[model samples]
Target: MPVHRRPPLPGVQRLARALALTAAATGVIHLGVAPAAATPADPPDRADVKAQVDQLYDEAEQASEKYNAAQEQQKRLQREAGILLTQVAAGQDDLNRLRADLGAVVAAQYRAQGLDPTLRLMLDNDPASYLAGARSLGQATARQNETLRDLRERQRRLDQRRQETAAKLDELEQARHRLAAAKDEVRTRLARARQLLGDLTAAERDRLAYDDDARAARGADRFDLGNEPPASDRAAAALNAAVSKIGSSYVYGSTGPSTFDCSGLMYWAWRQAGVTLPRTSQGQASAGRRVSLAEARPGDLVIFFKDRHHVGMYAGGGVVVHAPHPGARVRYESVSAMPVNSVVRV
Candidate 1:
């Protein structure tokens, strides 16, 4: 009786993979390396340190976002690799089957008293010199053909395996690096925050705590998006796609194949092209290259109102696509109509 063996559970494997990937990215993103270009031991002021820490936190968030993106890319690639491996296996099976059939044909041809083509030529030649040369050549050709076939098959498999291995290793290593970097970013920010706490006088600390409590009452992350989106190839692609959707109809909160509201249009376009964007219009407005109306590209999001009260996809030809109001379909209207604010290029 044969013992049954079960393959690993895909769900379990996927979960494990997710954890491993997260761990690796954390490790790579958070190196315990020395600080960037040491300065004099003036030991920065508490407020200054606090500001620096805040900046570092911003950096950390950026790094975390990047790690998340890389993680997704790595996962996608792994699935692709598996598919490629399956194709490689099928190729090998087909090759072996074909070789077996060819062997049978060759054997049957020789067994029926019909000469092996290779041997026939040898027998037809002069007994000494000609026959000897014919025999040597025939045997050499036969051996060479077999060797060539074997080598070709092996090479093909080897090439495919090498490509797959290289891709996996590269993605795995990248994920590991990102993990480390992200962790380090968080750790550094926490350290700086702690240092700021230490520098505070008792009364100042109390005041700070009071301010924190006051801010807490407001109930918001208060996260400032102080910088532009990192320069990336995806930014351009995303921007370009959004630009093309100018004047498309909108349905409030609807992602689209054709129509979209302000945020819905962005979400749908980015998600469709495999680039993730935030779900809400306000979130989408802050997610990319922040710019002024003068700098806005066709694909960039043109935000409106002082507090960013509205948004629209900047479709060129002096038009933008957006849901006009609460109970309306998204449609394209003049950029001039709305109070144009900041622009965000993905």
Candidate 2:
């Protein structure tokens, strides 16, 4: 049996040299087996699983924010609908009383046995005065007609109020359904993530946690604040406010002085600067003047990912202050830490 050596192709020669350099950089190699044609190594199972879990978590977080927004909307609509229902009930009562009074008036008129009620009243009081003052008879007739017209108008208004209340109730119901769906979606994604993590070994789980911690630590702001000037006074103030919120825990649907989501953090920070931001990151993406990353000021809002679901306020020097996600706290990170969709100056 003869062992034949195959000559390396031009491409293979360069690849072999590159691999040799890489092995040299690492300073470790098999003594006898020359770095032969490099073979692709199997991807690490832990890393692959970790990536899957991360993706699931990211999707869940997105859904969670939407659920929070829907919940807020549902609550607001419910309150409005309740108030409308109360008003409708009150109006219905008023209409019922008015109709009952009108019915009584009609019943009294019917019992009068075809007599002209106004004439009867005049006759009952003073025939001489009734004859001398024809104006009194005319006034009595006008008042009777006006009472019927008023009652009819009030009934129509009450009916309209009922219709409006019904419409608002329908809106409230729709909002409730949306909130429910959003919540379910978040739950489903999180459940799948939990299951995936359960399949991993304890060591793999620890690695995942370490990876997250490493990512957060590596994401520290590398920008010098003094190098980049804010585009506006409000932008500067908003950026400062956002920076002040560093370390506040992230909470879904929260836009506050204590905790916040990505967009919530931006919303609260901008609000502090007298600028109102929208509730969701997608909405905030459109709430300002679009600018290039180069033109972004310290207070500018930076939206990330193609769907624009995440947001952070620029903290100057290529860094941002944002609520990264669930289980994370507000912090300053590199603006380019995530795929940037756009920069907005509010």
The per-residue C-alpha lDDT of model 2 at residue 163 equals 86
lDDT of 1 by residue, 37-126 (tens): 423444324454334444443344333344444555567677876777777677777667666766765675356446665576567655
Q: How far is candidate 2 from the true structure (C-alpha RMSD, Å)?
A: 12.1
Model 1 CA deviation exceeding 4 Å by range: 1-46, 113-161, 198-342
Give the per-residue lDDT of model 2 (tens digit) for 264-296.
888888888898877888888899789999888
List TM-score per model, in order: 0.41, 0.73
Clashes in each model (backbone N, CA, C under 3 Å)? 21, 0
Error of 1 at 109 (Å): 3.0
lDDT, each prediction: 0.56, 0.74
Name the regions of candidate 2 deviating beyond 4 angstroms: 1-44, 100-127, 132-135, 218-221, 224-226, 256-258
Compute the lDDT of residue 3 as modeled in candidate 2. 7
Instruction: Name the 10 consecutive residues with the lowest summed lDDT in model 2.
Output: 1-10
Best by TM-score: 2
